[model samples]
Target: MPCVKIDMIKGVRSPDEIKHLAEVVQEVFLDKFAAPNRDRYQVITQHEPYELIFEDTGLNIPRTEKLVFIQIFQQGRSADQKRALYASLAERLEKDCGVPGSDLVISCNRNEKEDWSFGYGRAQFLEGDL
Candidate 1:
């Protein structure tokens, strides 16, 4: 399963756009990680323009434009898979959402089975939820 959270400037996209983004992410997970149809995936998107800030803390500088941050979590995905996935993701995002690849920053992290509790504090996948 791959859970993704996208944070971007507020008023940047409509609901359809947001759903398209989620679909794109899901497609990437399915194609790259070989996630099954029964796999549970969740994606939460937050749009905050006024309060959202992009800065270079190391250089003590503020970024002039908005940025898209995508955080994806998968249970068992290889580094090579991630690398290839991001490339395809960026291209698709640019083509579908008009978000340039340069503006997209994706973070891929590993999640162990013990870390997720789907329901009732259970780690196993529920039938209906899947």
Candidate 2:
């Protein structure tokens, strides 16, 4: 399972647009990361323009108010999986959400099954509830 956090500047997209964007990301996760159909866990946060900052990091890619920052936290995933995820996200986001590859930044973090607790003050993974 992966928990995704999508951050962007407020007012850049309408509410429907944001929902569609999240759905697009979820699709990528399902196709590339092998996430379960009901395993969707995502948070979309919109901040004021002044609350977000991004730089090209010397890649010379242009940054804009439409920038999207996505953080994916999950368990083991192979490097190839990550590569495909990145490529698919870029292409699909551009084609479906109008988010250019240059304006998208993604970071994936690794964790263990024990790190998640779905509910009830319990470690569901450890308890075999998941």
Candidate 3:
């Protein structure tokens, strides 16, 4: 399973824009990452303009209010697959949501299958109830 946490600047995007952004991200996972619908776990958090901190991180990319951070936690993916997923996320989000790759920071943190508890007070991946 993959869970995405999207953080963006508050008051900069309309409600519709945020909703569409989440949709675009989910579509990328479904189409490019091949994740199942049952695996969807997406959360969006808005921060005041000054509350969101960012840096060039030596990439020399300038910061802007349009910046977004997509933190993904998941298990079972090859390096090549992860690369493709990142590329597709940048491309699709730019094309569909008008958010450029330069303004986005996408990171994936791999975890063991036993780390997730989808619901019902169970670790479905280990319990075989998924």
Q: Tens digits of per-residue lDDT for model 2 on 38-118? A: 999999999999888888889999988889999999898999999999999999999999998999999999999889989
RMSD of each: 3.7, 0.6, 1.2
Best by TM-score: 2
Per-candidate TM-scores read: 0.80, 0.98, 0.93
**Model 3 RMSD, rounded to 1 decimal:** 1.2
**Decoy 2 TM-score against native:** 0.98
The pairs that clash in candidate 3 are none
Best-matching candidate per lDDT: 2
The lDDT, on a scale of 0 to 1, for candidate 2 is 0.95
- Stretches off by above 4 angstroms in model 3 are none
Winner of 1 and 2 under lDDT: 2
Model 2 CA deviation exceeding 4 Å by range: none
Q: What are the per-residue Cα lDDT tens digits for candidate 1 across 71-102?
A: 88877787889998999888888887777766
Clashing residue pairs found in predicted model 1: 10-49
